[model samples]
Target: MKNNKPDQQLASRRNFIKGSALAAAGFFIVPRHVLGGPGFIAPSDRLRVASIGVGGMGAGDVRGIFSSGKVDMIALCDVDDTRAKQSREAHPKANYYKDYRIMLEKEEKNIDAVSVSTPDHMHAVQALMAMKMGKHVYVQKPMSHDIYEARMLTEAAEKYKVVTQMGNQGSSGDGVRQMVEWYNAGLIGEATKVWTWTNRPVWPQGIPWPSTPIAPPADLDWDLWLGTAPYKDYVGNLVPFNWRGWWDYGTGALGDMACHIMEPPFRVLGLGYPSSAECSVGSVYVGEFQRGYFPDSCPPSSHITLRFERPGKEELEFHWMDGGIQPTRPEELGPNEMMGDGGNGVIIEGTKGKMMCSTYGANPQLLPTSRTKDVSLPQTEYRVPGGSSGHYNNWVEACIAGHGSEEFKKLSSPFSVAGPLTESVLMGNLAIRSYDYRIPRTGSDNQFDYPGRGIKLVWDGANMKITNFDPANQFVKRTYREGYSL
Candidate 1:
């Protein structure tokens, strides 16, 4: 009664006693088996994680994070029980919920990190919420649904001082690192052009939205699944997959694969935002005389050209072809050789020589292909453990190490890097969407003129605006539904 002591000191003593009792009883503590292996990490050193969208790609993400053995899977959230079955069965002990907001509210003190693997439209909202809470976040590719969202997430990461990673595993692969070393060593001098191609849209695109609506599955919460996206009636085949082709819910083929295919060139050349963008898209035929125009759906194919300005150097030309289109084969490559992993790949042209690689920067090769075997350079880039496969653990360990730690700096696709790359990828979409922009003909009710077509869009990256085409600016950011905000 007479002694005066700080509340913190008294609380510390109480915590010590409580911790000791829990350790002795093995209750309210990590199991001994979980921390007893040869390289066991203490419970205090482990990262406690909660995952949203635990199904489809989300299930794989969950497995990858848990495989690290340096994390505790504390909670799981998903809108569809059917899609969440695999992860739920795999982590039976973790708390499960349908709404991520409720899960975060109740478990905020329990989770140290969050993994977001939802559709393209939902990525930014889920990730922003976690980062605002000072929790580390690992979000799937493209990082966001819009350019403005990408920019915001990038800035928020720094403001909150939280660890972050984008789910582009290829960024951590040995192939990209090797390419970096080669470029730094001048294997290909002064890159002037880059070509990236992917045969995606494996789902339906260049088509009209389904006319009839159907009831959502019994276990699926359709409203929750449409988080951040404008409300629409349930359409069959749009769930579990196939959302990639819709402008409302997905970012189309460019968003699906460019992050993997174009990353090598972006990293190798140290490229920034593009100064301009233009594109041409393939059209579908509705009848013998009519060209089908479904503005809401992504086209079947597109060829986008983006130009980047370098103050002291020649402007760089970047090409992106999707839906089976590819650049002309380099003369140095053999006629019969496969190009870009046979479906997706990248080629960089330089003033002196050229190099190429498939998606995820895998199988990098000099133009001749033969040069890849003969040319060698010292490895200047530090390799992440397990290469691309170890991407999940890299983030897990980094989160455990905390922000500003050495491990955090080593993250392959942190928001600082992934953010710009995502912006560039989304730029291609902006051009594609602009190519489809239409205006009602001066006096006609049905006929329309496509003014956004046949025009190159001038981009002001700093302000995230399209200076030449005001209509295209609408695509830079989207208005969220009533309850969702960045």
Candidate 2:
């Protein structure tokens, strides 16, 4: 069945191209309705798209592009045959290649945009290369593995006149828009402190190294998978999905979830890059092996606090607690409005009244409670016009029409916000790796005195450098493998 699916996909593409040519030639033609509907642009008018790293996330992206009717999927690229096969089956009419560069060089003009769903480490290079070719880009979240790449991609997107959207799906949802609405409404006064948490500490939980290498999968090109990271023999356990836990490939739990968790606080508060950020480690994972592989023993769950000294007056602190972490609720919050365990959300404590929101607050409804009863929120419905379809649809529309509209911008324009948030999360990961260190922390609630511990690191956004701590800056920028320099 799997083998037949690829063959069928290929046949459908060949037929579509043949049929499209006939219609363009002014000959009598019949519509087959390849995509979900016929309202989208025809194949000839569609943007040519190329898919890179078409495995899990990549395959889903391919489907989105093909279904949008805004683009014709011309190429499928991936290091793994299993995923490549999935994309090929989903888009048989497009050319297929194992290596993305080969597809880029071979089908240069055949593509107008590139959808990149690779690992955290490969995002910067793939997107940068596509932008350099004048191709629009839709990359997955945490935009880049480090600060330098994030800054570079943001600049390059502007320079190349390409439309860009980072793939934080929540960024394209109504929930995020509602968060913005509530923030604008001042439901949370002043917005002094923000707390976000995740139930991570699962795969890469608590700063541990990965296990030893195993034989690479037969259908997978392991070397290509490693991409820009330092070469390590294929570890069977790490590939496919566990990459999220390792320092070399993934951004740990904080990196994986912070973009989603931090969006509300950033949008509502209009917070910029923090002047300083330090990580506090409740438990540490020691040894170089810990840096390289997953440790057999898990590190204790801990909270990472990031402090920002805002422009106006007092300092603001955003605490990111994960691995079974919860925030200390303000006394004002009703008993029933208390947050959930094994779930994710953010709590904003303000002087006037406290505002609580979950990570996935689908449709702006608060968790029902008797004591809290029904807190009347304004009946404002903010919809993601094209996003109701998919994240790639918004990008496809923007790519074809030039500039993204206000709605599209509102949906996917969190790159600037997500960039700094990712940095703070990565910094937290670094702090945890530094073992048990009493780093300095300053920032109080309501001008009250409060002292804390963690490595107090200062940041210089202008220079993209974090001073006062050298070790903290180690993860700020990454080096490229021999041939993959962007």
Candidate 3:
């Protein structure tokens, strides 16, 4: 897993980051002092890249980087041949393969990076391989399937000297950057509470647990699709798209959307990993819903809670509601108020005022008519010029600059920020698994068990382990398959 030569080069680039002048088309260009160091590959110089799991999201990533004109699309790999064929059609010049490992082994010298858009279960393994080869990575959202994978990915990237960016495109939006500026300027003074909500129950609910496994589809390499995950027979629901609701291949409702909804709070408040997390759901609701994507079971609905300690600042509480459960707005806000308290959004209530923003960092509007009138955002030279093209261009620009600029180095959101958010959401999934076994909330004086069996599970991020509950710790890492030990 060591790529020392390339890593040393990247270290050199970190020392050379300089120049602040704006280039043509408003893009920042670095002076030669910043561009001459090691790990600095020129934009015009040929760079090779590969795509792993080039289905739904992967296909889009392939096209985006292709448009950037910074690299050659050398290889496309996926467990599904149908999508693989489509990827080949989309990029006729690229080579295609069923197994990513085969592609990596055969095309190792040509590739400098990898765009991993695989299912949650496969992210760490594919990305790990790419990093081991001294390749930069563009991994999709919910960066890891579990807490351990998040830590592992970060370590591997650092060890390998690869430029990395998570695929939470919303993090690149100007709206999010604006939110961070506002938060920093104290517009939302010492924010105490934050809420993120989503309407996700509609897709995978109302159906009971699936009993039997069906034959694998003709186009899928079922074994490869199940890479690094628990062994299971193929099921139709697991294919194409729809896998985000299942525990085996996905991280459930919160994992699927938390990265997007939780983006603003993480970046603005500098909130790290939560100290502990809990879940609550209606008593009537059982594991009545069948996992639409994989052969598993999940609760009909739940309200997940995550808490963080920010010494010298307000303690933050992030509440997640799926299936349309929502937070009650502060009653004091008078009439003519509009709240983004619907399916996807974050509500920040501070000492001075409150703000509501749509999910994916769009449609940001401060609450309370007076707050918008009075509060002012701080002036900063760096502003993310917003557009609809998504995060693709941002990474492309970084890749083109290579080691010469701070492009990707300056951008760490969706990865570092999304890690804990995704971990907190995974706690919701843990709560459901341990619904009959409630745990004590750390720092609480009461000895009585929670009203329901849900996790108030304590987290220890520095150690990369969950405290208090052994069962919850079981989820920190997956039981990787025999051959693939990620």
Q: Which lDDT tens digits does candidate 3 get at residues 1-486?
A: 776998888877765553222333466647654677965555455457899978778888888777755668888998888877768887788888888889888988888878899998888888888888877788887788877888878777667766778887778777677677777777767788888888775556424445788988788888888888778777666576666657777776667777888877877787777887777754433356622322254555678788888988766888888777878865645655545645677888889777778878777766664666566656662544334354776666665556337775655452545566566666666665555344566777654353335337777878866677766677677788887876
Off by over 4 Å in 3: 1-46, 205-209, 282-295, 332-338, 369-378, 385-390, 412-414, 436-455
Task: Using lDDT, give the best candidate's number.
Answer: 1
Write down the TM-score for model 1. 0.93
lDDT of 1 by residue, 1-486 (tens): 756668879999999999999889877755675769778777878999999999999999999999998888999999999889999999899999999999999999999999999999999999999999999999999899899999999999999999999999999999999999988998889999999999998999999999999999999999999988889999998998899999999999999999998899999988889999999998799999789989899999999999999989999999999999999989999989988799999999998899999999998899888998898787789999999999998898899998999999899999999999999999999999889889889989999999988888999999999998899999999999999998
TM-score for candidate 3, residues paired by index: 0.82
Task: Flag the better candidate by TM-score, 1 or 2.
Answer: 1
Report the number of the highest-TM-score candidate.
1
Better of 2 and 3 by TM-score: 3
Which residue pairs clash within candidate 3? none
Q: How well is each residue in 1-486 modelled by candidate 2, as lDDT tens digits? A: 257988899999999999999989988835545553756445555788888888888888777777766677888888899867877887778888888888888888778888888998889888889989998888877788777888888778767777888776666666666656666666655767778887865774444444676788899988888999889888655778888766677777776777777766776676766776655444443665443223332244667766777777578888888777687755655576547333787776664455666664333333232322455557464566654356667677777767546534644553555566556556666555543323334573433221223446677766776677665565567788899987
Model 1: weakest 10-residue lDDT segment is 26-35
Q: Which window of ten consecutive residues has the lowest lDDT sum in model 3?
A: 290-299
